[model samples]
Target: MADETESGERGNVKTGGCLCGSVRYEVRGELRPVVNCHCSQCRKTHGHFIGYTSADRNDLVLAEESGLRWYQSSEKARRGFCHQCGASLFWEPTEGSSVAISAGTLDAPTGLKTVRHIFVAEKGDYYEIDDGLPQFPGTMRGHPLPEA
Candidate 1:
């Protein structure tokens, strides 16, 4: 696999559209730390554990929002989805500094590098996280790390 550093230096912009293609977005800046979230809510929302990445909201641009939907998942967090097809798109902290874009939503070759695993204790019993990334016992809410 190509390293994220090499891929990022190429400025290969990653773009994705909703399942129905009504909503589209482009991640234009360098991709940073990526994470796999195993929280119950995430698993329920995506029908599986979700992969996410931390990025400055400014780095994300909704090229089209005709089918976008925002759900306030909690007092401090909200999740964006495709209203037309109910495809989960991204998660953002209501007051934090960054956004967590669904890694699977991005078109392949996004230069995203997985650096950690979260909500391990709450993870579904059906799958195992085999990646060597750091595992946190729960959600990463107030840590000094980036949004993912």
Candidate 2:
């Protein structure tokens, strides 16, 4: 929805917070569509596949960050969470144009959809991805699924 910011410009502003409301954030402008990541690391961190939507780093504003904590999940990225409620919230790469936001943390009516699945090769064996969406064994950046 369009929101009026302090600058008086109407923008696509979305708000979300941690389970305890200790880590609130606002995103300005558009957000990327949701992408389900089934990587083992993501499953371990979120207890399942993690749905993420991304936005430019500059577009994310921390409205409240009293409980924000970061864990360096890998050499290339860090995970952001709320220490108070243990909400797994973000995945930010060491050098990237955008930061991934946990889809579940965003307030409802997000107007987003999960378009595809990534890291499918590492997905847990217990669940079947029956949604029929495109699946990639790894990232889509350079690896596209072979023609069926």
Candidate 3:
């Protein structure tokens, strides 16, 4: 994913799910551009770097969660995944500040792009961050996410 620009909010609606369709969700309103996360926890959860776009807690709605399970990764954060398919679905702050939805799980034509990379300092040595986007050693909120 590369950086791409989009216009005003379209009140767009997006739907996504786990590989086994056990966890489905709907996100309304505008979504932030994709941010590639290189933190160790993210890499372990998704089996690699995790690509995600975010939205307010109010905008993300889980339509189905029969197979959804949340793992409290740390004191301040927890990760959501499908118990059946073991697909990573979300990363959210324990305070419910916002939710990070996996970009790959989103339905096509999301009109989203990779705006930057986060936690670059912890990135694995197996891959290189060749993308020219800004690489931050912290979270997007820590660096203030760039414009789309």
Which has the greatest lDDT?
2
In terms of lDDT, which candidate is stronger, 2 or 3?
A: 2
Expressed as tens digits, the lDDT of each residue in 1-148 for candidate 1 is 3334533322446677678887788776666677888999999999998888767888888988999989999998999999999989889999867888888777766656777888999999998888777789997657555542
The CA root-mean-square deviation of candidate 1, after full C-alpha superposition on the true structure, stands at: 5.0
TM-score of each: 0.83, 0.89, 0.88
In model 1, the number of clashes is: 0
What's the number of clashes in each of the models? 0, 0, 0
Distance from true location, Cα of 110 in model 2, Å:
0.2
Candidate 3, residues 45-127: lDDT per residue as tens digits?
87899899988989887888899999999999899999998999898988866898999998776888898888999999999
lDDT of residue 78 for candidate 1: 97
In candidate 2, clashing pairs total 0
Q: How high is the CA lDDT of each candidate model?
A: 0.80, 0.88, 0.84
